[model samples]
Structure formats: structure tokens, C-alpha cells
Target: MLSLTDVDKVYLTENEAVQAVSSINLTVENGEFVSFIGPSGCGKTTVLSLIAGLFNPTSGKILMDNKEITGPTEKTGYMLQEDYLFPWLTIQKNIELGLIITNLYNEQTKKDAMTLLSDLGLDDKANAFPSELSGGMRQRAALVRMLAPKPSLLLLDEPFSALDYQTKLKLEDLVFSTLKQQNKTAILVTHDLSEAIAMSDRIFLFSSRPGTIYRVFDVPAEFKDKLPLEVRNDPNFHLFFQTVWKELEKVENQNSNTS
Candidate 1:
């Protein structure tokens, strides 16, 4: 399980100090998927970074399975909007990179990574370089690399934002199913509301600047078992989207007023 208690973060620059997030308290159960959404500059990514242990919180604490997260650990993996795969490396090398860095490399780890590549339909591209694959395929390769280490918690920072609409939808289903099958806990920071509603067990909505949890929307139980694409087609999807949309609009409007 992952827990954040009254977490606050402050950034200092030559000019002044900025509070990015404040009073954040939440918990994510094992194998649960959660998404954070709000207007730009609401510190959604800051919260994710704190969870990833990229930096420590200025106040309070973040714990994973009762242990504090002081720095990046092997228990968590991060994926971003860009694939960040090395251009000179073949897909196979890219996939094995994480395992090598974490001292997890071995014949068995290689086999498992290859199996995941095959599962994502990238087995044939093992010998290919990043430039040889499409954006979507490279992202899939990146996913394989991230999963190769078998991290229990995955931090996804708009991993699908750069893909085309169709590719985004397809990848969403693939990722949702893959994580569920592996029983991985994931925290996604996305600007897309429909994407959030479709892929998340719960959505954390944040207030404007110096972000705080504005609300938490629990996905309907009926949609839990459905893939993201199927969730979009469900009648209940729009109902829930509208509910979150109204709240998000309020957040955006508040930001405008304060600005």
C-alpha cells in the first residue's frame, strides 16, 4: 500500500519560494490504479514526483508499505510523455537496460522481458532501433523496459499524451490490462478527463495553485473489470465524465478568477 500524510512541497528559486502542493493526504491500496487531474500548474506532476521519491516533501511523509520514500527505489518505476529510449540502442537492449541497472539481469530476466515484448507485439522489433519504430511502438518498448524491473508501483506521467487518438486508446487498453494481470499499483498524472475516467479506479481532482485534493471520484464498480476502450463505450462512462467535468470546470474557473 502507498500512503501520503499531510504532504507539502515547496520550491525555492532565486526570486522566491513557491508552494507546489499542500496538505495532501491519500492512500492507494495494493494493485489499485489512481489518476491525478486538474488545471495546469496545479502541481499534479509535483505530487507524482514526490510519490516517485524523485525528491523529498518539505513537510509530512510518503510511505510505501510502511517505509518512507526518501529517494528513487527499485520498488517504483516511472514512465513519461516521451519514451526516452536511447536512439542508438536496439529495442532488446533498451528492454534489458533497466534490469542491468538494477542488477536484475540474468537469463531468466531476459526471458521474462522478451515475453513481455512479445505480449505487447514488439518481439519482432527487438533488433530495431528507436528511429525505426513509430511513436506508439517506441512507447510500448518503453513500457516493456519499465516493467522489466518488476516494480510494484508505477508512476505514469502522461505516457499516452503524445500519441494519436486511436493509438492512445489502444495503448490505454493494453496498459490497463497488462498492469491488472501483473497486479501492479499505478499512479497516473493525466490532463485528459475521459482517459482518467476510463483507466482509473479513482480520480484525484486538485485545486488550483498550491494544490490540494479538491475531491476524489471513485469509479463505478461496474466499470472496474472493463478495459479502457470498453469503459469509454459504456453508458455509465459519460455520466461519470460529466460529473468530473463539472468539477474540473470549477477548478479551471477558479484558477482564472484568482489569476
Candidate 2:
């Protein structure tokens, strides 16, 4: 569980302070999957960094469970647009990176890593270096590395952005299913409206730079049984997409006029 109360983030330099996020209030339930979708430089990723305690908010507070998040903790796992896997490392070693960091590696930790790769259909490639893997495979390996720590929360920052459309869809399905199976809470920051709709139980729309919470949309249950790609063809999908698109456009236009 996580809560952000009127959170604001400002970056200070020698010259001036730049506000990146403003007036954000949000609560994500345990085991929930949420996404933030908005225009570029709108602070979606900044908000995520706040949650991970990568950056402290300039004002207000971010709480995990009942306590404030001061800095990075084992409770969170972060996956970025770049896989960030070390090319020299084999897939298995890369997957073990998280465990090794926490000094929690053991027979069982090794076993868990092995079983996770096996379940993800990457068992045979465990000995292969990152350079030997395809883009999708490397990303999958990255996900496995993040999941290895057994974090209660997962922060996804455009995790599939660099992949081809077909590969992106497959990874979306895999990641969603894996998160559900692992019962991990997630907050995703994505530019893609459909990706947000297909993956999130709730979607938060943010405004332009110095981002503010523009609106929040709850994904309908009609497509609950469908995967991301399958949900795409569902009639409700297009309808909901249109509604979300309008809200985004409206906010963008408002931002444009004021600027």
C-alpha cells in the first residue's frame, strides 16, 4: 500500500528551482495495478522516483504502508525503459543481481531464481550473455532480476517502450500475469494510452510540466478476463480509449492556451 499526499517535487540548481510535480494526492491499494499516462515532461516518472525514494519530494509526503519513505528500500523493485542488464553477465547472474545486492543469496534464493527463469521460459538461455539475447528476451531477463528481490511494490517506467509492437504486447501479457501471480503492487508510467488501459486497474492522467493530477479513470471489468492484446479488440476497449483520449486532449489544450 502507498499514499501520496499533496506531493510536490522541485529541482534546485545554481540558478533557479524547477517544479516537476505538484499537488499530487494518490493512494494505491495493496496488490493493485495502476498507471500514470500523460504528455512528456509531465512528471509521471518523477512521481515514480518519489515513490521509490530515489528523490525526495520538495513538499508533502509519500508513505508506504503507514510510514514515510525516506530513501530506497527493499520493498520496491524498479524496471526501466532500458533493460540495464550487464552485457558481460549471463542471464542467470543478472537475475541474481538483486539477491546478491541484499546479501540474501542462498540455496533457496538460487533455486527461486532458477525456477523463475524456468517458469518464464528462459531456463535454457540462463547461461547466455545479455548480448546474445534478443531485445524481448533481455527485457524479460530484466524483469526476472527485478522480481528476484521479492519486493512488495514494482515501479515500471516505460518498461516496454523500446520493444517492437508485437514483442511489447507479449511482454505486457507476461509482466501483467507475473505481477498478479506474485501479488505485487505496481505503478506504471507510460505514454501509451492503450497500454495504460490494457494493463491498469486504475489510470491517472497528469497535466503538462509542473504536472498536476488532471483526472483518474477506473478500467471497467468487462475486459477483466482478456489479456492486453485480446482486450484491444473488445468493443469496450475502444470506447474507454476514446474517453481517456478526450480527457488527455482537453488537458493538453488547456496547457497549450495558458502557455
Candidate 3:
């Protein structure tokens, strides 16, 4: 449903232009969950911003649902490192933020927010403020808010990094299932190789800064049907993890030597 062709991004300072990504060509199929894994300073997040139309690309193009992306569209939902919940607003109101922004807010939209909270077991906390809930609950509430608008594509940017390990793992399943149930396409950018391996149908490995596609690995057929935790516990988990880890190490080392 989304594709990037020969994409490149550059940032200009007073002195010189810095290239962030180079020739990033990618395609994410409808309802597919894809993850981008790379070292720090790589252009993974840049690619997401391009897809989200947060800014224009320096070269090449990004297409969504067969249309070229020009600017941010309501069909995409973004979840970042922090929940970004409004402390003054109740969870229910926060969940409806997208609807309100789109001028789509109405009684049914409010009910839909509540329904999402209820389904996610956050209904009990719907009336609570952000400061009143634990981090995990707040993040779950954030997910409800992101999903409230029924976006077709979800862009996740290391969203679980601040959470504890158990909570992170739990939310992984929650997010994976939620997207599947809603039939939403997703693109995740993460430094966590294991997280990417466990959650993605396919993982896109990127090179160091001025990032380009290094390799695209499809999860083994046997593990494709498994959930995150199940995949994590499987024997091949180590193998997949180690393979990516070694690849990342190689990328880093090669860059270091060249630089």
C-alpha cells in the first residue's frame, strides 16, 4: 500500500548539505507489518517522516495507496517514543483528539473512542487523567487514541523504548493484534533487532548514516504464524537475533574502518 522509490533526504546547514538517506526503494504491501532496523543516525525515522509527508523528499517519491504523498494525510497514524497525552484531558478526550482535529468529532466518534478503550480494557480508566495512570496504561491509552481515527497505516517510531521489558513485550502483542484485527498496514522503525524480528513479517535492514537498504529478510515460514512472545521463545529466535546482531556489528565495523 506504500512504496518509496529511489528516495533520498538531505539537510542543509549554513556550511554544507548532509545526506541522510540514499536511494531507499521499498514497498510495503497492504496489511503487512514491516520494520526498519538500523544503527543510530541511520535514516529510518527520516523515511517514516517522508512517508508521513511531514516534509518533502529531497529526491524520489513516496506513494500511498497509489497516490504520491504530498503532505500529511489523515489516513496515517503516528505513534512515537512518548505517548504525548494531554495531561489536562481525560483519557477519553485524548483518544478523540484525532477525530476532533479532522473535524469528524461527533457523538458516534466519542462512542467509538469509548468502544476502543473498552475493547482494549482501558474503559475503566477512560475518565482518568494522564498523570493518574501508570506508564503502561498511558501507552495503551495512546494506542487507543492513535487507532481511534481508524487510520489505514500506522507509523511507529521506537514507541516502546521507555517502557519496562514486560510491558514492552505485552504491548507488542497488543499492537500486533490490534493492527491485524483492523487490517491496517504498519511500518515500524526500531533499534531493537529482537523487537523487529519478533513483530515483523519482513525486516528491512539499513546501513549506517546516509542509510540505504542493506538487506530485506523475511521471517521464516514456520515462525510467521506465531505471536511475538511465541516467536521469541522459539529456538530460531536466537538464530534470527544473532544473525541481525552480527549483521549490524558488521555494518558498524565496516563504517568505522572506512570513516
**Every model's TM-score:** 0.99, 0.97, 0.97
Model 2 Cα shift for residue 106 (angstroms): 1.5
* Superior by TM-score: candidate 1 or candidate 3: 1
TM-score head-to-head 1 vs 2, winner: 1
What are the per-residue Cα lDDT tens digits for candidate 2 across 115-195?
998898899999999999899999999998998878999999999999999999999999999998888899999999999
Q: Kindly give the number of clashing pairs for every candidate.
A: 0, 0, 0
Instruction: Write down the lDDT that model 3 would get.
Output: 0.88
Error of 3 at 151 (Å): 0.6
lDDT of 2 at 170: 96
TM-score of 1: 0.99
State the lDDT of candidate 1 residue by residue for 25-81, as single tens digits: 999999999999999899999999999889999999899999999999889999999
Top candidate, metric lDDT: 1
Name the 10 consecutive residues with the lowest summed lDDT in model 3.
219-228
**lDDT leaderboard ranking:** 1, 2, 3
Quick one: best TM-score, which candidate?
1
Once fitted onto the true fold, the runs of candidate 2 whose alpha carbons sit more than 4 angstroms away are none
Model 2 earns a TM-score of 0.97
Q: Spell out the clash pairs found in candidate 2.
A: none
TM-score of 3: 0.97
lDDT of 2: 0.91
lDDT of each: 0.95, 0.91, 0.88
